[model samples]
Target chain A: MNAIGLVAFALVGSAKAIRAEFDLFGVTVVGLVTAFAGGATRDVLVGRVPLALQNVGEVALGLLGVCLAVVLYAWLEAPDDRPITLYADAIGLAAFATAGAIVAIEIGLPAFGVVAIATINAVGGGAFADLLLDRSPFILFEDFYASCAVLGGSAYWLFTALAADATLAAAACATVTVGTRVLALSRGWTVPTAQRLEAVTGE
Target chain B: MNAIGLVAFALVGSAKAIRAEFDLFGVTVVGLVTAFAGGATRDVLVGRVPLALQNVGEVALGLLGVCLAVVLYAWLEAPDDRPITLYADAIGLAAFATAGAIVAIEIGLPAFGVVAIATINAVGGGAFADLLLDRSPFILFEDFYASCAVLGGSAYWLFTALAADATLAAAACATVTVGTRVLALSRGWTVPTAQRLEAVTGE
Candidate 1:
């Protein structure tokens, strides 16, 4: 599951790097950070050395994903459009949200704790990647991005707290996140910008 | 020492936010993240719940720093210039570097681990703030920033490993980091950018 998420995250990171026209080294750096930073953040908060640092396999998988992204970039004539990027991001978000929430739950964190960890873990990598590239983090404004993670994480915590089956809870978490994201994309839903509020207040 | 670093970091973050024309909430968010993110990152990687989350005093200190920054901004007619910002940054870097190195050493991390953790803890907050504001992270290109952290961390580790007194080692670490940064500023030292390599390699 983590390996799959790594690939998805790498692709998202790589695409962003390519859009920024970063060199190969830059691409790899961005991809690796995006793929591992979330889990690393989670592990660090839990008082464990990040698996990304301890496990050779995780690092290798991240590298493989970056290399594959580079290869794909070389092969493709055109850059990816918005839809493809959003979909990939959604998938990665759901994966990490479920994974992070479960970890939080296992540690007996409260509902808020579970949601916070899950949301941060799901989106933190992309945020790090964007920040490194000198862009405003996507989580700050990207449509339904961190929101999905929050909702999914909360749902997961709710289900688990209510004595739901583990697999069932996990599935529900993933489904809600992905489904909300897809709907938000199709419906053009967005978290309102502060600019709108300022205009309304006329301040 | 950590509290001082937190306050200093909040000032830096708040200054950046003011420069970016962020509203009050944005300023507070940026300030809090800047003050806490470094230590939080360190704690998380070490598999411990972050002190920022666990300790009420720490949170209160962080808030106080942000409020102070906001008040300062309101009182001041002009935003800070580059030199003032750099000087404040240098102080923060020195403090966090020494503290982080001590923690890493006490935890029995290897020399490399000590350096990694120390350097990251020293500069991670500023990096996060820069990224959030859509500016290049200072450590990536700022004169002798992370380099100072590396040197300081290594110096601390070496001193401790060689049976030097703890206070003396910490003083040496801070002095080296701040002294180097000050010298770098006075001497107009800058990190050599990769763009220079592009010119040489014609890539």
Candidate 2:
């Protein structure tokens, strides 16, 4: 399951690199960073060594995903690539958020920590990639992206606190995150932003 | 010394936030993240729990640093603020790089790891802050900044390998990083880019 998440994250990163017109080396590096940074960040916050550094298999799989993405980029053009990247990104986000929430729970972090860590873990990789490419982070200006992770993580926390089975809780988290994001993407739903208030002149 | 470094890092983050016109809350948040992220990253990579998460005092001091930055920004305009921020940033960069290099050495990392970790540790926080503010990362386009850290870390690694005293190695690392960066800033030194590549069409 972790492997699946990692591969999906790498694909998302590769897509972003492709969009940014990065070279092959940049694409590969971005893919690796995106797949690995989330869990590594969570591990650091919770006072543990990151598993990404220890698990060579995960890294290898992520690199393989990047290679696959390169092939995809060569074979497909824009409109053809968007859906696949979107779906993969959504899945990766859900999986990582759920996994991060579980870790936060295991570490006995507070509610704030659980949600914060999970959301950050889910988004950190993409954010890092965007930063490297000198683009605004998707999370800061995208449709229902980070909010989905927060909702999912919160749901997972709630379920676990209520003595729900671990698998069930995990499922709930992944479902909420992926479902919401997919719906938003398909329907073009977006969060509301602040509007400027009109100035009133003395009439 | 570590405390000073942390404070300086937080101030650097705060200065960035001020430049970006972030609200107070945003300033505080960025400041804390900048101050602590480098060590946290190094700890995670080296298979230890991050000290920032374990120590409340560190968090408090970081917040205090943010407060100090807020006051500085409030009192000082642009030209008045630049020098202080630059000097503090240089100090923070040097201190973090040296500390990260020492950790890599203690953990028996390869020479590459020492330099890579040190450079990453020195720049990660400010890079993150810039990313959050939708600015290009300074390290990607700056003069002699990351280069100084690489030099410093390499010097530290060499000194350690030669069985020099730990304190002396740290001093060497700090001196090299700070001195190089300070000179570069004072001299208006900049890294060479690919501008000439555009003119080489015929050649």
Candidate 3:
């Protein structure tokens, strides 16, 4: 799950940097940061050393993802909004969210903390990448991306609260997150914006 | 030190949000985030619960700063880049850097980690606020602000390595950070950008 999340997020982040016309170095840095930042943050919150700093294999996986992204970009000519990349991104989000929920649960955090950390683990890297690219985080105002993680996290907490086995809870969390994200993508579902709310109320 | 840093950073963040024409709620959120984000991140990195989450007094101090910013904004026509605000910002940066260094040292982090955390603690909030405002972090490419934190953290580490008392080291760190920042401001100092370096080297 960690390997899949790292590679997928790195690919997603590298695609964004490529689209932004960043140099190769910038693209690679963005990719690595996207892959590692979320997990590193999770570890810090749990009072552990960052996995990335301690494990070279994880860094290698992220670099492999960056290389794949570069290859895909060259082949596809425009891969940023493509279906393949989007699917990979969804998979990554689910994987990270599940992983985060497990960690938070193990650490005996409350339900809110579990869900919050899960969402943070799933989307923090992308948010950081967006900031580096000189833009507001898309998760803040765009589509239904982060909500999927939140839902997945909540599901994990619920399953655990109901005394489900750890593996089952983890699987449920991942499935719920990926399913919701894919469904949202296909159905064009979006969270309402503040501007939209104001318009509706005529205020 | 914590109180001073929180209030100053909150005021600075609120002033920026006001300049960006955000609503009052947005301004308040930005202020609170700017004041607490860095310290919270540092705490997380050190494997402790966030100070903001643990203490209501800290939150209140940040809110006070936000209120102060709102009042100044209403009175001064523009408060974003005023001398008073700039000085306050420098002082906040120094205080946060010192605080972070102390935490990292207490946690037995190496010199590099100490300096890195100090810089992060000093600038993380501003970077986050910039992200919300849809801009790249100024520390990544702008003036020499974060560098002062780096220098101060290094000074702290060096003093400790030389067997100086912890109190003396901390005082030196804050003094160095603030002094350098004020000097940089007065001299209109800026970090050399990649473009500038490229031009100089005729790359």
The candidate that wins on TM-score is 3
Measured with DockQ on alpha carbons, how good is candidate 3?
0.13
Local lDDT at A79 for model 3 = 65
> Which run of 10 residues does model 3 chain A get worst, by summed lDDT?
A20-29
Q: In model 3, which regions exceed 4 Å deviation?
A: A1-32, A44-127, A136-203
How are the candidates ranked when ordered by DockQ, highest leading?
Answer: 1, 2, 3
CAPRI accuracy category, model 1: incorrect
Tens digits of per-residue lDDT for model 2 on B18-87? Answer: 5665545456657877888777778777777667655668777788788777666544664224776678
lDDT of 1 by residue, A1-203 (tens): 55677877877787779778999899999999999899888877776668888889888878877877777777774333446655766787899999999888887777656876888789889888987787777566546568788889989988997999989999999999988988887997766443444445555
Q: Worst ten-residue run, lDDT, model 2 chain A?
A: A194-203
- Tens digits of per-residue lDDT, candidate 3, B147-194, equal 899899999999999999999999999999999999999998776532
What DockQ values do the models have? 0.19, 0.14, 0.13
Q: List model 2 lDDT by residue over A23-140, tens digit each.
A: 9899899998889888887876777778988988989989987987888877777422477667877888899999899998887765656776788789888777777877656565
TM-score of each model, in listed order: 0.61, 0.59, 0.62
Worst 10 residues of 1 chain B by lDDT: B73-82
Off by over 4 Å in 2: A1-101, A108-116, A122-134, A138-203, B21-29, B68-73, B78-80, B192-203
State each model's TM-score restricted to chain B: 0.86, 0.89, 0.94
Higher-ranked by TM-score: 1 or 3 = 3
Model 3 over residues A1-203: C-alpha lDDT tens digits?
A: 66877888898888787776565545666788798888888888787966664465777899888888777775576665788778878998999999899999999999999999999899999887887889778999879999999999999999999999999999999999999999999998899988898999995
Report the lDDT of model 3 for residue A25.
49
